[model samples]
Target: MIQNPFARFLTGFVVAAAAAVLPVAAQQAASKPDFHQWAATPPMGWNSWDCYGPTVTEAEVKANADYMARNLKSSGWEYVVVDIRWYVGNDTAHGYNEKDPAWNIDAYGRFVPAPNRFPSAAGGQGFKPLADYLHVRGLKFGIHIMRGVPVVAVQRRLPILGSKATAADIYSKEGQAGWLRDMYTVVAGRPGAQEYYNSLFQLYASWGVDFVKVDDLSSPYHKPEVEMIRRAIDRSGRRIVLSTSPGETPVAEARHVAAHANMWRTVGDFWDSWEQLKEHFEVCNRWAPYIGVGAFPDADMLPLGRLGIRAERGDDRMTRFTRDEQYTLMSLWSIFRSPLMFGGDLPSNDAFTLSLLTNKDVLAVNQRSTHNRQLFREHNLIAWTADDPATGDKFLALFNAQDQELAPASEAAWASSIITRQTPGQSQPVDVDISGATTLYLNVRDGGDDIAWDHADWLRPTLSNGTQTVPLSTLPWKTATAGWGQVTAGKSVSGADLQVGGQRSDDGIGTHSNSMITYALPAGFTRFRATAGLDAAGAAQNTGGTLQFLVFTQNPFRPMPADSVRIPVTLAQLGLRGPCTVRDLWTGQTTSGVAGEFAPYVRRHGARLYRISTARK
Candidate 1:
């Protein structure tokens, strides 16, 4: 799960605090003045989870913090977050508060920092030293926490805030009464419940904390807790910016989450994958409207460049995304107003990767552009419009996620096309003219879509690892076909083509002996198509008995173009006794009927000629 680092810490703190004694003043401080005005704008910066996972150390965090201030601060990337457990060392035999199997905060769980790890903090201080050090450096500090009161609080028979209450008195025995059970449940509006929250934040506020992320408290499931946590933060009198996590924050609950949090995860964990990135495009579109001046629908962290672990038993090192796909991921996220949180290792960042994260123009969209929602999604393409009110100029992003690659990444490729209305009603054509900015900017490296400026015709291609920025006019779209093939082959690929009314052909499209004839299919598809085709040695490949059929959609979304769905049919199924008919799925009409189309293997690769036509009545 992609968690807000600060919230993850708070989860542990909440668990531990139930057992620790709190002074009476702490309870009063919990209901004090508001704490949000401190974070006038959304917080920015890098976190350690995408790189370190449960084993991150103090030295590494400090290094990342140092790097952010020295390099990324000018780009508006500020917060330096240490994610997950820091209460216990890698060894569990130690006094770590291990809990339910699902949320253990030890190794294989969230790790707590061993006293040996950070000698500066021993007496339940947690990240106070780190937080104070960051403050001295003119930077904000933050940590993560899970939701729900801790089970430990219940075990100790701890004193509840009001009327000398005990833990058993507050916990809801009926699971249905609350959403979470891994942690002790708190009854909202109870005499001591508010005091519990107040006391939690009071300790945090005194610990030099500037940011608090409260997790598992989003959505209708935890509305009451969300409100209580927000109140607690405000009352603590430490203007901390609240962030919520793990997404699924429904539209109806947007107003509530937005009111309390500086940011909330809009989707689940966003890994570095073309498929995941593509999925996020649709999800981000849905949550964009909730993003505003002080609050953002966090798209999660940028798992770019380098990730995983090292040493004895580590994770795989290969990048989850291609250079081009990474560009698309960043561009879409930036244009959508998602908070920019780098999840990769800053200590070992490559030059190319750093460039992508630190690009001035791209960062501007994420940090400065006016928030905007998606305008439309069709033909597998998604487009959005954001107007810079200060300059009265609109910034539009047209994305083509179609799976098409022309050639290898040699140079930046450019495609000039019309952005016309789907339905013919406008007097002016949506011809993108990037002819005006003093310095034309394009994030060529972030690949799913190409960025063009209206005033400046020059579009630069940036490599994903952030390596090179080549002019688009100089690159070839030929390598683009590769991306299409990959997309159709992704995990989400349904059947590429299906032979309706059953029969196969031997005719194939765009297939030479040199190119492999492969097809994508849905999970339960049981049909195909075949056409006449010759083999490598000029020998005919005949459809004898039962050839397989396939079906799938076009891989990448091309910007505002006709959507293509691939269908394959087998000659045996078509029963090609007469003309074999191809039908449309939406209209249920035969597309084409041909006689004596007796063939073996017919594969129409990237079908561009077939139109969505109706059959004769």
Candidate 2:
């Protein structure tokens, strides 16, 4: 059974704090270090675990890095982090092979990159070459490591660098991390323990690493090891952002973690599931007080787009979340100021997936907002608020927690119970009335039954003083159609066309030969279009055996027209008095014109994305 994160944290924090006592001056100095200065804003990047798992390779990392540099770098997406077990040579797609293990270590008992997987690390060269390559491309590199000294170091009794005591002298005979089998905790204040951690960061700094995500450290709240790691990073003469992981990190240790690390996981490994996303609302709310510059409570990675392709936990396929849920995930993470890490195969991202990453307006809320708080929650309906630091503009987010579609009547009832700012903690029933409002925004979950936007049902809002009903149908929304690629000849292809299914001969690097499609969009188009098909029948089943519609302006797989489309609808039709700029949500480009209709060509199972914006002069 999973233990309660808070209870476990409180218990561990008390015990660890009591056991690790240092000089009063030293403890105060350690706590006062300016760790938050490294990450002034929540870091946005891509990580490997959600897609490739233990089987990720140097080439794959470079491919993702190239993608980020080319497409996402301009938007402040920087870090390219390799997750756990990079030092294990025998690690495969499924999981680690412990019985026939191959360990990579230096003479000083520090784990090094497996030379087989990272050829640059061969002959004593660690990740220096890879880090250099990333730096040249204007990207930051990161690596994952577990807490404590390697068990092999202890067993081999290697001498700790710069210390007379050996690894065995510092290793604790009791309390190995429960999940990882290769390490043993180092006893705090041991003669060689500090030197051991120092040497580890020294090596990392030599390699030009910008981030270090230490796992198995937060849940048990190993105070001593955390301090040791912090001290090592400080002494390395480099600025490395520290991230603690494998959480539901105890809420009780918020301040402590913030002082020691840049970002800490507030939940366990998140996946493409609605249940997990729902649970984050409460967890984020509980940890909201601890968020600030450099100290972010991570919501884990965004498991959007194509994930688990040859990953350890599951099979290769697209994510299981619906388009609506994906939007909700992005909205919640941004408003709460959680670190945004994309956890899908970057090379295989669809246009819609790329749009989700490139949204500048949404990303601003995450990168520049302040005073984030959960304004109110009523049963399945939840609301959040954040203020833009520069302009003091308030952004509000409403969430529908229920799985099924909420009826108009029920929406009004729920909206009525939302007590406004004045009536804090008390609900006074009021009817929602959004009459004569110049601009109305509707947060609708679905496109009406057909492609038409005018037929959507409205959601009523309950305010402190009055109530307002907003028509969802009148709001600008997205519409899409999706289905599975038909199986052919014992195989599966992405489009309606079916062909021979057997695998093709490998192209030397373990990939099968396959056909590719490329297309461009027409000018003055409002509809977003995309096509999703499986590479193989087996991979399709691993991905829920269905096609998902996602909207994007630029075609993800091919070049598309860059010309802007003039939507013909007038500002009056959209409840606006002045001129409005129609923005393409996928490309983050704006086209100024009267709102009109433009039907863009869409391939079967494709998607389209668009939104309207108006500036008051």
Candidate 3:
């Protein structure tokens, strides 16, 4: 049961002594705090939007708490949150909620905790009892709230705590300013405004709230509200993790948000789509450098396994992602260090979905690593690599995002130049070859803001002798946008396994069946590359391979496949060093060469990789 006295504490500005008497250096030093140091710690927790919706109940919250303690505590997942409309709602008997008159009493426009929902939350002490309960069980408690000062505060002329101010004095005289009028705009620097913000934090602090996720703060450039909230939270003397919600914050604003809030969203609500996944993959890689401890760039929720439980406006569809795609999504998110807030109903978790969530290797990448990867997509495939600074292990993931199963002879599209062309008036392509791809590893960061990619063309090829680099200007350009399309190319490999767990029954290593590793082994191989697809003309209905590669072998990195195919390769048909092409990232170039010595073998992760040694053209 949640409990906390509903009270508001207005923030008051403290006037510091004049700094003119101090040394200039001391003044500057005084102004600087080790914000990065404060944020280095990893955040752990579970959100309520998954299992329960707006009508979340105390009994269900307790059950979730019990589950976290028994199964996920050691795994560092804590924080039992009651998400959305907790104050003005009641528990739903079935899967969805019905409005109950007993729960109809509204505390102004602010959705204060409803007594029917939390019987123990006496006297408007919304989440205090639950927070205390979680604390006793070695867990933490959190709740969700919408942005802006509550509308009830304005109507009733509620007195702000810790000051002689009223809510009406704090909110902007202009009232709501955005298309969304759900929250009243509270301008910072307005009389009693800081105090109003401070009072809200004081209430949470008194309630023992460890986390507060505020919605509607990102869309309207609510920097004033955001800044005031930060100051109030800091002044509350309690360490509360602040999370902003609902939309993508611009790259320029990422640093600002990082300085104040613990996390910010990087995209609109993420559902399940191969194209959305691909777009998100590209976006995550682009922002990897900005992420660090404390501040995280949220990629939205993990709508995996199950979805559409709340007022969420999607058909209740089981995820359409293939097993291979699920693996790709998890691996990529883990590598990019995005938050893994599952959106599936917990009690109904299937064996396969549960297994996917609990995979130790996958979780390690998301929570333990310290570095992140940079990715480039060409043709129907994406190339990803992260370097481990500690052990020098290079993690790599290859994805086939095309709609059609690719044939052997089709031409692969190049995505290496996509980044360069994103800038206005930059019509030319880059120069480079994809042949020099290597096994670079990376460290994991909590937020996605610290990661930065200064220049798209700065990537240097990891090439061996005779590796030809192509300039970008030579290849023709094609445009792309959201939805209703397929990218295709020749027969391709999908996914990678950095290290093979062990030998398996099918003579492959992936957990699922049919995944095999492909590679073009070279004598003293320092550099190797392959080309697949970036764009396709028409859609193929699960017919051909969504070309991808996965690595299963550690000592010798190998590419894995979701399914197997018989590509007839006879030494008599083609001399050693066969004809092949690979995309280049640094210059956006694709160079063709003869195929190399080919021996087909399935590695771990049920995938295969083909090593194509290029012959002189």
Q: Model 3 misses residue 324 by how many Å?
A: 2.8
Off by over 4 Å in 1: 1-36, 91-114, 160-163, 173-182, 310-318, 404-617
Which candidate, 2 or 3, has the higher lDDT? 2
Best by lDDT: 2
lDDT of 2 by residue, 456-486 (tens): 1111221121233222222332321111111
TM-score of each: 0.57, 0.64, 0.59
Candidate ordering by lDDT (highest first): 2, 3, 1
lDDT of 1 at 355: 76
lDDT of each: 0.49, 0.63, 0.50
**Segments of candidate 3 deviating more than 4 angstroms:** 1-42, 90-111, 173-181, 315-320, 404-617
Better of 1 and 2 by lDDT: 2
Find the 10 residues in a row with the least total lDDT in model 1. Answer: 450-459
Every candidate's CA RMSD: 22.9, 18.1, 19.6
The backbone clash count of each candidate, in order, is: 108, 19, 116
lDDT, candidate 3, 231-272, per-residue tens: 888788777878787656777776677767777777654556
Top-TM-score candidate index: 2
